[model samples]
Target: MKNIARTLASLLALALTHAPSALAQASCSSDGTPQPVAIFERFISADCEACWSDAATPAPSATAGAAVLDWIVPGKAGDDAPLSAAATSDALARLQTLGRKPPVATDVHTAAIEATMPARLRVAHGMPFNDYLGTAIAFTPVQRAAQRTGAAPAAMDFYLLLVESVPAGTEGTKVARNMVRNMLHGTLDKRNKLSKSEQMKWMETRSMRIPEGAQAERLRMVGWVQDAQGRVIAAAQSTCR
Candidate 1:
């Protein structure tokens, strides 16, 4: 099993390029140069046993990913969050090039996320709520099945919550959704053995929601995922006022 996993990881490594440094992360929306969302990272050291305790590669690592960058995005605020295709594409492309462990340890870096974050962002999870200074997009989870019949999920489900309402004239809500979440969960390639990047990617993939044209005032949504039997997986929450 170990040999197979290593082989696969090597194969993946061969296909990937060196990851861009955290500095490569963008500071603004494509059109809006001002609106910036804060970035918190927790890259675990190679010697950190806590980092790998969760699994072969460890999803919820006990070791912390380093909190690297936090910058505010400057921009004009509109009511609804703008969905950017370019931003999404760039994010996906970056994920395809993972060469090493990122300075991100999921929940472990949330505290830094809130303190350093310039704008309100619905963080993925693990940071305390009181520390959050700005708007956040939190949500609960819902479940879906695989296209294959009798195909058990290779791994657990991922979820995001939209408890916080993103109102009009906010600094950078759209940037938060696109950059922060995608940065966390966009790299999701799976081999027999898993890595932290793959797990985070899975989380981002399944978790998210909008209240179906609901006005953005004190609005809240839950992003979560469940099993075939409707059992809860994991969830996060963020809201707007």
Candidate 2:
């Protein structure tokens, strides 16, 4: 069973490496600037013995341009007590909205491996809410010339994420990577359709409580845009000032 899983994972890795998309390319602009990336958020429980491997998975370098968020929750598949109830609830809501099953250790490996891929959109000018109340994300439309040669979707969905970089964790254990504290979802204006002629701006703000264990200085805001099919178009991250 382990061998089968390993083989499948390897195949998937190969596919992602060669996949052609704005997100899969090295540079999205003629000037050699990399496009913004999508956020890779993973949900897990500390008590789940199977989740340790994933929690230990290292994050992609900042140069990769992917912001990873890890949500630690408590439940049947989670720990006896979550590090932050607000964070857990936020993650649960996102997974439910996406109709995805609770993530296991393998999912973490998948996210880390996939982080190397390019992103379809770029996240720019991200900022945290005043008083640590929430975060604001700006969705800037991709330039027509920079976009992949394909029909643009009539509309897109946007999600705002509050992420904490590496936080204090148990000694001798794999360090927890990016941890998502909250998320806010929104849809772009259909009339605007994210046209390249003018950068269609979609902004979102989400209020959240930073977990007790999180380092306030390490907080970040991530913004991602997706199409109607739930395909990520672009993503970006910014640190709290």
Candidate 3:
């Protein structure tokens, strides 16, 4: 378990900041859009202010930092759950009062949020015990183990999805670039021929030394989905990232 956490942490860090050779050898598909990786990072409260964070005045990342946490955590599930109407009211008021910046970026849509989030936050691994927007927030079991052990998780408890960035109207051949399926055009119909090959390649190169000056794009999408129970599902990108 300790090794698992260590490995997972290393993977996370590598995904964020790997050496040049570690990236070039990756079997990037012919597709072009930049894929987005689903990293098991944390999100704090400050970013989700709902003003600059939402559409109209977007931040660089429509889906980064605290927004990720809000997406994974359940919102309103229980009738007995304490409603935060006051909090909501205050938040909304702040937004209106602030007079947001001049269209920094569009607000994050609900669909984007959903897609960015996992199908469901599994609770099997001692994770937060609620569905998206549910209550009883806490870390998943494997997540806790990793935290406790102060190591990367050997067995992560979620699916890490990699996404690709495509232009608004690019379809067909170009669409395959995205790692995850978008709502409008969910997943690629054709099976990915590259993923398996890449895996095999990864196995072979796990021990190989990276050559000099071979870094690639900023990112290649890959993500980890964790359920409330702490079950981890790993889903690498088929086409994009």
Which candidate should be chosen as best, given TM-score against the real structure? 2
Q: What residue runs in model 1 are displaced by over 4 Å at the alpha carbon?
A: 1-153, 157-201, 205-213
- Per-candidate TM equals 0.21, 0.58, 0.22
Q: Lowest summed-lDDT stretch of 10 residues in model 3?
A: 129-138
> What are the Cα lDDT values of the candidates?
0.26, 0.49, 0.25
Model 2 global lDDT (CA atoms, 0 to 1): 0.49
Q: What is the C-alpha lDDT profile of model 3 across 49-124, one tens digit per residue? A: 3421222322225554221211111123323322211112222322232343212212232212223222212111
lDDT of 2 by residue, 1-241 (tens): 5445444433432332233242233211111334345456566654454554445554555556555677665456333433324336766677676677655432442222222223343332212223333334444544463265444345667776666666446422366567676566777674433344544444433344455555666666566666666666565665322
Q: Candidate 1 or 3, higher lDDT?
A: 1
Candidate 2 regions exceeding 4 Å error are 1-38, 49-63, 77-79, 82-87, 103-106, 109-131, 142-153, 167-173, 190-199, 206-208, 211-213
Q: Return the candidate ranking by TM-score, descending.
A: 2, 3, 1
Count of steric clashes across candidates, in order? 55, 7, 64
